[model samples]
Every structure is written in C-alpha cells, then in structure tokens.
Target: MTTQRTETTTLWRPTGPEELALVAASGWRAWPPRLPEQPIFYPVLNEDYAIRIARDWNVPASGVGYVTRFEVETEFLARYPVRRAGGETILELWVPAEELDEFNRHLVGEIQVVREYR
Candidate 1:
C-alpha cells in the first residue's frame, strides 16, 4: 500500500516593519482549535525592538510597525497551513531576506538581545 503526505506552510506579509512585529508579538498558539492566551510582554518588547530599529535606521515609520494586514498566499500540506506554534515565523520579520545587511546594522547595538536569534 502507498500513502500520501502533505506539508503545511503559511505565508504572512506585514504592511511594513511594525506590522511584522505585531504579528510576531502574537504568541504562538500552542494548542490547536483553541489558542490559549500567553504573555503579552514579548510581543510588546518585539514591537519596541522594531520601533527602535526603525528610528535608529531612519526607516521612516509613521506609527507602530506591528503587522496590520496579511493574507495566506499558499500552503504546503494543508490548503492554508498556518505557522507552527511558537516557531520561526516571528524570526522572518527580524531578518528579512530582502534587506539582510541593513537589518544587521540596526541589530548591532542589540547584540545582547539578539543572542536569542543566534
């Protein structure tokens, strides 16, 4: 007998940097069908981090860069697979592939905090 398998993946895009941070702030829902509430501190802190990066880098942000709007483009296994609870989705915004070097410069002053990323 043969078995079929499918992989799930979610694609999220923030309006800008702050929006990206906001989505990351939303803690990973460990439980499926019922995502429990988690600490808001990390999200808040991440928002702060994104904002500080914006200012220091002169990214020209109007308000908080928390992810305001996004949509799922495609999925790997599921029709629209969501992010794994507390997974790498959050990191995507931290180190955008487009502007990797620029983000690094903004992150230089934050070596201590970035230890988590490393």
Candidate 2:
C-alpha cells in the first residue's frame, strides 16, 4: 500500500516596507511578533486578497505597501482552513499572534516581493 503525501505550498502577505522591515530584521525567515493589543496574524491565501489589502488599506496609511510571496508546509496549512469573508475570495488564514513562531517554522524559504502598491 502506498500513502499519498500532501504537498501544499505558497502563501502570501501584503504590507508596507516598514512592516516588512519587521520581518526582514528577523532575517527574512518569519513574521514578527504582534503588538500587545494585536491578537491575530492574518496571511491571506491569494494574490488578489493580498493586493487589495496592500492597495486599499496599507497604502493609505503608510503611503506604500507590498505584496509578498512565501511557501509553507502543506500539513501546517491543513491545521488552518481557508476563510472567506463578504463574498470575496479572501483565502485568508488567521494565525493567532502567540502561534506565529510555530507558523514561521513551516515556511519553506525566503519571503519574496511580488509587487508594490502605492
């Protein structure tokens, strides 16, 4: 008998350079810790959702935003199912702030910049 292995890959996030710095300063390997008042870290599932947030929310507040791509272990993603909100293909996953370190451990490689929003 052969067992099939699940190979899920690719996750994305959008943020301003300042925010990206937080991740970069940590060696471009993982997301940074959340602020005390912050409760969850959201990594969207699709480029569109990430782009929208980067363009709509991030740019307005920070004057610029970026869309980043990364990979995560499939099994880790299975732990958090995709979520949709208000009919958008949000493809969002909410990782509790406290669990971010564990989540980062699943990243397959360096985070990359796919595009920028301004």
Candidate 3:
C-alpha cells in the first residue's frame, strides 16, 4: 500500500467584525465575496503581519478585529506571486476578486479564528 500526502501553505487574514460574520455564515468553510469596491483579497504571509492589520487597522475602523488562519494547497498557491507591500515582513498573496471563488475552492480546511482584538 502507498500513502499520499498533500502539501499545504498556511495563510492568515485580518478581518473586521462585519467580514467575519459573513465568513461565519459560510460555516467557516469559505470567505464571502468581495464587495464592488473591493478589488482584491489579500491574505498575509505571516501571523505578525495579520496581527498588525487586525489590531491596528481593523480595531480602529470597526471596534473589533480577528485574525483567521487557514491552509491552502501549496500547488494552487504557486499560481499567485507573493507581493511585498512595504517592509521586509509585509508579504501577501493578492487574489483577484474575480478569482476568489476558485481561491476558496482551493482551501484545505475550514477557516479558524486564531486571535481577536477589541
């Protein structure tokens, strides 16, 4: 008998309360579609970056924030290049809004809330 292992890359997303609610409504299995004004869905490469956005940006804007962690097939992630938005630690995978449905299909498992800021 042979066993096969699936490789996955961990990603984190910083979300506000409203967005988190939609994710919950999906049963934590998928992210909601981006609004008309949201052109892209960027998931951070590291927890520190995600924490920074959730704590500093989301909290101030919405009074609450959450850091959600999830995994995606490593092979699928190779299609998108890692974008450095600022400093060395600021890395993200920018998934186009039009492709988000395909992105969600590549998720390895249910999204989980790893941290929260108020």
lDDT of 3: 0.96
Model 1, range 1-118, lDDT digits (tens) per residue? Answer: 8895433222222233433343345342111121244211121123333344444432444443222212211231122123233434332322223332332222211111221110
TM-score, each model?
Answer: 0.20, 0.89, 0.97
List where candidate 1 sits over 4 angstroms from the true fold.
Answer: 1-4, 7-14, 28-58, 62-118
Comparing candidate 1 with candidate 3, which one achieves the higher TM-score?
Answer: 3
Q: Rank the candidates by lDDT, best first.
A: 3, 2, 1
C-alpha RMSD by candidate, in order: 15.7, 3.0, 0.8
What is the per-residue lDDT of model 2 for residues 39-114, given as tens digits with 9 covering 90 to 100? Answer: 9888888898889999999999999989999999988788887888646687788889989999988887798889
Best by lDDT: 3
Candidate 2 yields a Cα-based lDDT of 0.86
1 or 2, which is superior by lDDT? Answer: 2
Specify the poorest-scoring 10-residue window by lDDT in model 1: 109-118
Candidate 2: residue 96 lDDT (0-100): 90
Measure candidate 3: CA RMSD.
Answer: 0.8
Can you tell me which runs of candidate 2 are displaced by over 4 Å? 1-6
TM-score of 2: 0.89
